[model samples]
Target: MAFLLLGFALVMVGASGIRPCNLAFGADQFNPNTKSGKRGINSFFNWYFFTLTFAVMVSLTAVVYVQSNVSWAIGLLIPAMIMLISCAFFFLGTNIYVKVKPEGSPLTSVVQVFVVAAKKRRLVLPEQPWLTLFNYMPPKSINSKRPYT
Candidate 1:
């Protein structure tokens, strides 16, 4: 009974941590999208998988096997500790990682999508040579279906 409850609690907490940390860790990679961001992204990918699997290995195998019993509270603490450490590392790495804007944030990707769409209406008005000044491709197949609408 105790073991089952412990497992359930761990599952809940572990899942919650995984979702946001996944984003936080993901953003940490491309902090600037430049040379430094490239290096940061590379390092984050290599280290992220290594630590993730290694932590999982220790939690499932070592925690259960080495701990030797489910009669005590220690079995549960392993995951709690994992959460603690994972979250701690998230904050610890924040200065190094790119920041993840919250969902619905103006900085989010959808904001730029709106900007692009709003601007597209004007893109078609310019003549071919003038449109070329912005490096935008003139819409092809103009006679086929008038895609701009």
Candidate 2:
């Protein structure tokens, strides 16, 4: 029973981690600026959802039936084998995929903004609003020794 619960928890965690990354990764494949890119993105999402729904429906109906009526071992093995094949295909196409390098955590910037706002909360505004505003500057490269302003 404990092992079963642990398996469920692991599955929940894995699914949660994969769901956002999968959607973002798929959407990142297309540039939505051009007309064809826009159409491609739309079509990609439509097909993605359609296939997802179909898989869920089939799994719930057919897989459940197999597990309940047929051999449970075979039913369980089916998804495991499918997942193995999926991973194999993904790794095989690694060279063709658009691999984006990881940027620093976005949450840090959000926290910094809130901290700065709290620190400056008591400050008086200048007569001219423009005087208080600063121009947007891009962050320096990762290799730079200088800290982000």
Candidate 3:
């Protein structure tokens, strides 16, 4: 019972993480801004879904057939072996795959702004307006005429 509960939790976590990560990881393979890359992305997703559908059909039919007609252990072993092979292929291609670095979270900025405001609540403002308001100014790339919406 404990092992079953742990397996269920593991499956849930893996399901939540895998789909979004795989989609983003697959998308990272192509540059969507360019014509060729856009076409490549479209092609990739087209095949990806097709393969996914085919795999589902195969598992539903083939695995179930094997499990029913033959030994359940052998049927389970087939997929376990396939999963091992798939993992091996993924690791082999790791060097060629794009690795995206994590940028700091947006929430960090929001928290910093609140903390700064609270820390300065009792402080007197500087005599020069520019010195006091400098932190609130937009980046140099932003045009003064067009304030951020």
TM-score of each: 0.46, 0.69, 0.68
lDDT value for model 3? 0.83
Quote the positional error of residue 83 for candidate 2 in Å: 0.9
Task: Give the Cα-based TM-score of candidate 3 against the true structure.
Answer: 0.68
lDDT of 2 by residue, 1-149 (tens): 99999999999999998997887787767876888878988998999899999989989998899999999998998888989999999999888877566576777878978998999999987788675555534476343342322
Error of 2 at 40 (Å): 1.4
lDDT of each: 0.69, 0.81, 0.83
- Model 3, residue 65: what's the lDDT? 95
Clashes of 3: 0
lDDT of each residue in 1-149, candidate 3, tens digit only: 99999999999999997976787788778986899999989998999899889989989999999999998998999899999999999999999987766556757767878998999899887689787576676567434343211
| CA error at residue 106 for candidate 2, angstroms | 2.8
Better of 1 and 3 by TM-score: 3
Which candidate order results from sorting by lDDT in descending order? 3, 2, 1
**lDDT (10s digit) by residue, model 1, range 75-132:** 7787788779978996887776544444445455567679879988666564667655
